[model samples]
Target: MTAAVFGHDGPWTEEEYLALGETQQRVELFDGSLHVTPAPTPRHQRISRKLGNVLEAAAEAVRLELLEAVNVRLRPGRVPIPDLVITEQVDLDELIIEADAVRLVCEIISPSNAATDKVLKMHYYAAAGIEWYLLVEQETLTMHLYQRQGAHYVERSVTKAGAALELTEPVRATIRPEELLG
Candidate 1:
């Protein structure tokens, strides 16, 4: 069973952390523990920002919205601040806080979260019914797209800079990995 997050306006219910707001740390709550991550290196930010920019441009062209650095509150007591998260926030005005409304969640992995992104968090997002989860590695400029199936996720594509990502459900648009990695 999942526990409700106790105390404060931040993210988690089991514990407390203000490093993301106090310092430059890009932290998250993984299974109720405070995972303090280092400030994103230039390469990390480059990839994240590039991807956000690309999605933002596409959203504008399509008259939708793509968000970045949004703290998502998943029910299993996990609150992750993803690098480039895409949810249509135009008419919604604010995050629903407790639903599977987010269309996609993308993470540009740092050294600390390579396995966490690919393995652990996969179950978290999949269980929450998030439609898609994408993983990006800045060092090699690779993209891994996972779409949720019945109860698990099947890897849709493991792409490189030359490949294009196709968004199928909420929108059908193709974006080159190079444009997202910069």
Candidate 2:
């Protein structure tokens, strides 16, 4: 979740959180507590879209699919939405993408919630056994590709703007960071 889960009464169950349907705000559960935030900025949306487009072709060529802003259920109580996700094809009707079914989970950093993207969510993704986690820093136009090594993510590459990122795990894709900032 983007915001802290304190100053409230108690933690809310997953079912309780979902029942408060579609508030148009971004909502996630961290430590069984509800955290909500406003929608992303225009720059964030643009970057996410451009990055997804670059990854989409590679995903399609490999018979995988690219999904944007989809709920990824890491486990029973935690469901976080990443800006982009690449996964093996599954039925379209599935509500939340299971952690195992996901090959790669990507998050585009928002300035207001950078830690949640870089550290907090990264730990959760690694703990869920997610194989790949791609973190994009919008401010610097840098992408850090992390591969799951044993129980944690090991930094595989750090590509800067105008540089190309070559990925061999989770999927094969060459991404140019500059294209995402445009």
Candidate 3:
């Protein structure tokens, strides 16, 4: 309930982490450690919603599903709530979606979490064997797409505000960064 409850000396177990239940903040578990982040800004939410709508249409066409801010358990002791995830149809009643079911994960990168989204999460997602990663920059409205190769991910494409990004894999969708804001 309070910060003090999460300040113990030992590493947190997956059971213990999940037992905390949902809070207003975003909480993630990585290698027995918990990382709590503040809720996203309004601008970030706008981008997520618009982009999700686009992806949802594409996913439905391909029989895939697009989920927003869901718990994706990459592996034991590793769970991160991706901004948007395109996954194979999953049981609606399940509390968590496993890594194998995920096709692509997206994150809206704001100034406050630039390093975490661009670097830390990128590595973890790839390591979990998720095929694709999408990052949307909040300030410039730039979008970066990455594909996994071996143990890491390589940049597939980058689309700026005025440009449209054409995605061929996981699902087919054309997106323009500027359009996400409006």
> Please, what is the TM-score per model?
0.78, 0.91, 0.96
Residue-level lDDT of model 1, residues 1-182, one tens digit each, is 01222334454543343223434565666665766677888888878887777677766665656777656777655777777666655444443233365777888877877887777777888888888888887777788888999757888888887777776655566767777544
List ranges where model 1 is wrong by over 4 Å: 1-23, 61-63, 90-99
| Residue lDDT tens for model 3, 1-182 | 56645566698888888888878889888888888888999999999999999999999999999999988998899999999999999997787899999999999998988999999999999999999999999899999999999879999999998789999999999999999999
**Model 2 C-alpha lDDT versus the unseen true structure:** 0.84
Error of 1 at 152 (Å): 1.7
lDDT of all predictions, in order shown? 0.69, 0.84, 0.93
- Which portions of model 2 show Cα errors greater than 4 Å? 1-9
Where does candidate 3 stray beyond 4 Å?
7-9
lDDT-better candidate, 1 vs 2: 2
Candidate 1 weakest ten by summed lDDT:
1-10
User: Which candidate tops lDDT?
Assistant: 3
Candidates, ranked, lDDT:
3, 2, 1
